[model samples]
Target: MQLFEHNPIKIYNSLSGKKETFTPIETGYVGMYVCGPTVYSNVHLGNVRTFMSFDMVFRYLKHLGYKVRYVRNITDAGHLENDADAGEDKITKKARLEQIEPMEVVQRYTVDFHNILNTFNFLPPSIEPTATGHIIEQIELISTIIENGFGYEVNGSVYFDVHKFNETHEYGKLSKRKLEDLIHNTRELDGQSDKRNPQDFALWKRAEPQHIMRWPSPWSDGFPGWHLECTAMSTKYLGEQFDIHGGGMDLKFPHHECEIAQNEAAKGKSPVNYWMHANMLELNGQRMSKSTGNTVNPDELLSGNNDFFSKAYAPSVIRFFIAQSSYRSVLDLTNDGLLASEKGFYRLMDAVNLLEKLEVSKASTININAWRQSCYDAMNDDFNSPILIANLFEAAKYINQIKEGKETISAEDLATLTNTMNIFVFDVLGLENVVKNDSGTDKLTGAVNVLIKLRQEARANKDFALSDKIRDELAEAGILLKDGKDGTTYSVN
Candidate 1:
């Protein structure tokens, strides 16, 4: 049976702006598409937060026994500066500044993005399509839109006729903006634009003479628009109507709205069944932006080189911090918050370790089944990770109570508790133990044993200073030594 059979999952659909029960298009499978990063620069922490949110979603769906085909596209081309569908292509601009090929810029940052996400232990997507690779599909889509009378070409550029599309279908339905309001709020470009209306975004932009990312198209030697890539790649991989489409909340207005218009105008159907948008991440109380000197990258946070963090934090701790809040809530990255999450992470993992050493009793004081159900209930309600974490901490407290003989569990209940923790913490939450294992090799084990013996001798001889030095120094080197009733043991932290 499916894990979600008894506990139905509910998700907040951004399209409807309400929580709805999740039902996949297929019974035993799911298709999810999320917008990947535009590889113009190193990904910021806000981008990481958005990807991490979807990573959690992907993990939980697989844990529920669903075969999920996840597609996250790489924007190697088509994305523009300031997302205005104007200005230079971001990759082309970066290539010009660096005096390198546009592909070089894409390759460098794509590798960096993969490495950083790998360090954070994110699962690889099933299909990672690139925008450049799907230019033909995008061109075909634009031709269909033009044939349908919703697109027009002017001066070698193709623009989606937002006004015409709105007459047939709602153009801003995803963003809940009226067409009149959008026209009123649209800002005029400085130079003369070929677009009929300020809201009519580009389907294909005519490449400027200096633009390095040009490709041959029906209109001109140009590139696809920023909004066209997701629509093209997603439909190719996940089909016409998929289960979910997701991106950051900032993309809702014109980017996603244009995508909706393009897809409907071309295919006469909505492309996605559910729309999910992750909320923004802030630094201290302000939005993270490089221009304002308020942004911190993942490398800076992990290395503790940025002014925002007090000390270096492990990747697992960072993942745990993100998991402590609901994906829909605005998360503030602060030193104090990270420190607290660090403490909580260790506490939960320590209890998990202690579970193995716990002795089974004749009767159980706490109902493990009830507690397990509560954990599932929390996750079922829109992936409410904060509440799930609260339940996990409660289980941790119970583990401690059992260790202290204040509570007891049967052999069956003990097994259930152990398995539940392992599944939720490691599998569903995508969190690994921050501490490393030092017991794989006899040589390392012997070295640790020698240090433990030397420390024991120092304590026995009343050499308190030497003993303190040995323990503190080892702790600095990621080896934590714990003194217990039996003897001294150590773990790599």
Candidate 2:
């Protein structure tokens, strides 16, 4: 039997706003599409967080024995500077400024995107289709929408008739905003614009005389609109209706909403059974903004060359930090958080390294099966990684106790525990083991011993201020110190 049959998964549906038991369209198979980046610049850290969240989901589903075809598309063309269908194509604008071809810019940043993802140990999607490669499919999709009377042509450009579609169908259901509200909020369009309504979005835009990218279509020698490529490519690869559609939470309003409308406009049905959106990432405590200097790119974060972090962090530490929170919650990237995660990651790996050396006893003191089930239960509840991490720490504690000779485990239970930990840590969570000559505990003990000595000297000199500072700072870094009859000791959190 498939592993999914043994441990069912419940995914939080962005469309439904509730956790629903995940049922794939076909048995033992899942089709998932995530809206990928527009390759105009280096990939942002927020983008990395979003994709990393889904990477965990993809890894877990495969571990559950589901044959998953994951499609994440690249927007090499048609994404405009302003997402509302006005302004120059972002890639084209970048090419113009850099004095190069648009495809050159796409090539440069696409490789950068891939490199960063590789650094973070992300699994490449099953199909990484590009917008420029799917122009014909987009044209055909637009033709179908036009034939179905939901699209209109003006001059050489085409726009989806949102008012007409909303008459028979709910236009804002996915985003939960009423059509009337959008109409009220939108500014009045001048006579210069072609759209019949302000809420209408472009399906294709006519190429200007100096436009860098253009494709021949029934409407015009132009590029497809930003929203059309996803509809064309996702349906082409996954089908009219697939298992899941995912992206960052920011895409909910017009990007994903437009995809929904375009799919229903062409195929007369919702394109996905489950919709998932990973929450945004913040730097420090505030929202990451480039203008405000609160932003850090993936390269700067890993290299520690930016103003944010004190030292460079390994990819696995960052991955572990991201996994410590639910994908649905906003993740804050702070230096303290990363340091704590680095400690926790190494501690977990230290326990894993000790598993083989652990001596088996006559009886298992811990209930191995129950602990295993709790790990599965956390992941089953909407891919709750934080709870799963907590459970993994519990297992790590058990391993430490066994090493201290305070606990016992049978040979069978030891094997089971090792297999489960390996599968969840390396396979499912996509974390790489950081092999050290000396384990994390050994290093932490050395450092804490030095600090404990300094603190003892400070207390003996009646300098309580310095002693408290050392102790409190360690606590902030997720370490605890204790003084007992046997002098002082410390624990790595």
Query: TM-scores across all candidates?
Result: 0.94, 0.88
Write model 2 residue lDDT over 124-195, tens digit each, in one string.
999999999999999999999999999999989898999999999899898899999998898765543787
Model 1 score (lDDT): 0.89
What is the per-residue lDDT of model 1 for residues 1-493, given as tens digits with 9 covering 90 to 100?
A: 8786777899999999999999999987899999999898998789999999999999888988889999999999947764344559778888989999999999999999999999999999999999999999999999999999999999898988888888879888888899999778867765546778887878888888878788899899998888999999989999988998889999887788887788888899898988999999999989998899998999999999989889999898999999999899999999999999999999898888878778999999998999999998998999999999999999999998887788999999999999999989998888987654344366877888889899999999999999999999999998889886557767776
| Candidate 2 residue-wise lDDT at 223 | 91
Per-prediction RMSD in angstroms?
Answer: 2.2, 6.0
lDDT of each: 0.89, 0.90
Off by over 4 Å in 1: 82-87, 437-444, 450-479, 485-487
